[model samples]
Target: MTLKEATLVTGGSSGIGRAICTMLLEAGRTVVNLDYVLPQWSHPNLVNFQADLTDAAQTRERAQEIVSQYAITALVNNAGATRPGTIDTATIDDLDYVVALHLQASLILIQACLPALRACGNGRIVNMSSRAALGKPERVVYSATKAGLVGMTRTLAMELGGDGITVNAIGPGPIATELFRKSNPDGAPRTQKIIDSIIVKRLGTPEDVARATLFFLSPENSFITGQVLYVCGGVTLGTATL
Candidate 1:
């Protein structure tokens, strides 16, 4: 079947990416997901492709193929990993690995999608950064790379505005996803600390980030670009300690 235009979301097998895919699918948009692991659920409008975005060549190849096949109108660079370590424990390998997936792969996908995005005359790009970007201990490499995304978002917004593309970054703060649960757990001292630190006295949700993403992806927000929306329940107002 000839597919209609679609929105491409990376790391959609779970967490915030999955939430974004859910919202887009409910809106009747075809969705393409690229992740190393397949999502647990299925939908007629949702398609999955297994991709290890850390592999630069594989990332570019799949991106080209998907953008060509899907007529991609929007791109969401949401796949990321955190290599937790204090400055003394941080390693060169960790820096390279996180940078490869978070920064390099995001650029590759955006480049591959540019042709199709520009052709559509109204494209959307949402980069999933983190509140950790502000300054999170034990996440030196992750912080550097996520902050790199914010720089990329602002620059691309300027470069792609003429193409009718709006670029934005979402800085998620303490979302209670599967991964967060595994590390923080319920009633854990650290998790409770995070909740208390937030002005809203709660952790953010994947749905919160997804909603902000949808706002950026909407044609109605065409005039809003190069912005960073922190769905962190005001965690950003304090130190980004995690």
Candidate 2:
């Protein structure tokens, strides 16, 4: 009998991660979420593992266990938090913690899942990078880590291509998730400027990013890898539509 294939997602308790989990589950794929936070919703097809991904040892343990219990065909590294600070204010501690949660945790998860992903055939891996990766003010560390994820995505795509595992990244811009709003409040001038810069003249939604992720995971998208898809209302174009 064929075993059911599943997608493993980190930080799936809220915002973009939650949206990805919802979309994957709706696609008839089983989903396992690794997050220390409990989500507000649930489905029979969705399984939650309350593991803090920042903890490397625990991350490896849970990732291995999940792969052993399920055919993990896809992995979405969507767990990241920002520590906003200018050059003067950014502390070494900020760098350390974000690195643990962002870069190191992803590395650990990927390493743990490599064997199962190789065995699964046609496996997919999506890293949730941000336009901040290109460069964002007061977000030096966040930018660096997200940029690193992009670099890792490129390298892994080539290294794992022969294994039929595709790796890519989604770089979202000014998404209106809880995380985004924490810094860019609605009706604020800064927020307005961000909207105006978007060619779509609007902030991106979690669903928009989720759809891009699904596109990358699609069987028809087999030829696409080592690439970053920017789901940012065309903000990357550098001019607003209005």
Candidate 3:
């Protein structure tokens, strides 16, 4: 019997990541959720593997185990953390933590998954970036790591194109999730300002981001690569009151 080729997604236990996992399962794809926490939702195709991505040793060990056990055809580097602080207040520890999770972990996982991805012939890789990668206040460290992902995505697309693997990124803007609400708080002036700035006049949902991700990962999207699709409601264009 042939085993189903799986998509490995980091941080798939909650918020945008959880939404992605749900959508993939609905699309008849086997999904392996590599996260520290287990998701609340359950599906026969969804498998959860708990690992701290920030730890290099743990990441390598888990990535090897997952890739060896599963025929991983796609990888989504979606795990992230936000430390909101100005450059003056941001410490080395903050920089280290964000870089470790966002940048280093991705590098490790991609390396581990390279052989399987190559064997798949038509592989997909989607990196989870943020609109803040363009520029955002009080998120110097976070923004830097996300921007770095954009660079990595483009470079990998070029390097892996001959192998029939496409690398892309999704940069979500002002999505209303538990994490967003926790960071921005309800009724905060800054939050309202952000909502008003969006041309759609509201925040984006996790499903919105998930849909875009699936598009990039679809087998039909073989021509597209190294592109960053901003899942914002026209907010990236400019802040406008409507």
CA lDDT, every model vs. true structure: 0.92, 0.88, 0.92
Encode model 1's per-residue lDDT on 58-172: one tens digit a residue: 9988887797678888999999999999999999999999999999999999988888789889999999999989989999999999999999999999999999999999999
Instruction: Return the TM-score for each candidate structure.
Output: 0.96, 0.94, 0.95
Using TM-score, give the best candidate's number. 1
Better of 1 and 3 by TM-score: 1
Cα misplacement distance, residue 112 of candidate 1 (Å): 0.6
lDDT of 3 by residue, 1-242 (tens): 44468999999999999999999999999999999888887899898999999999999999988977888899999999998899899989999999999999999999988887898899999999999998899999999999999999999999999999999999999999998898688799999998998889999999999999999999889999999999999877853122
Worst 10 residues of 2 by lDDT: 233-242
Judged by lDDT against the true structure, how good is candidate 2?
0.88
* lDDT of residue 19 for candidate 1: 97
Which sections of candidate 2 miss by over 4 Å? Answer: 1-3, 238-242
Any runs in candidate 3 off by more than 4 Å, and if so which? Answer: 1-3, 185-188, 238-242
Off by over 4 Å in 1: 1-3, 238-242
What TM-score, to 2 decimals, does candidate 2 have?
A: 0.94
How many angstroms is residue 240 displaced in model 3 relative to the true structure, after the best TM-score fit?
A: 16
Tens digit per residue, CA lDDT, model 2, 62-122: 8778877877788999988888898899999999988888889888888878877888788
The TM-score ranking, best first, is 1, 3, 2
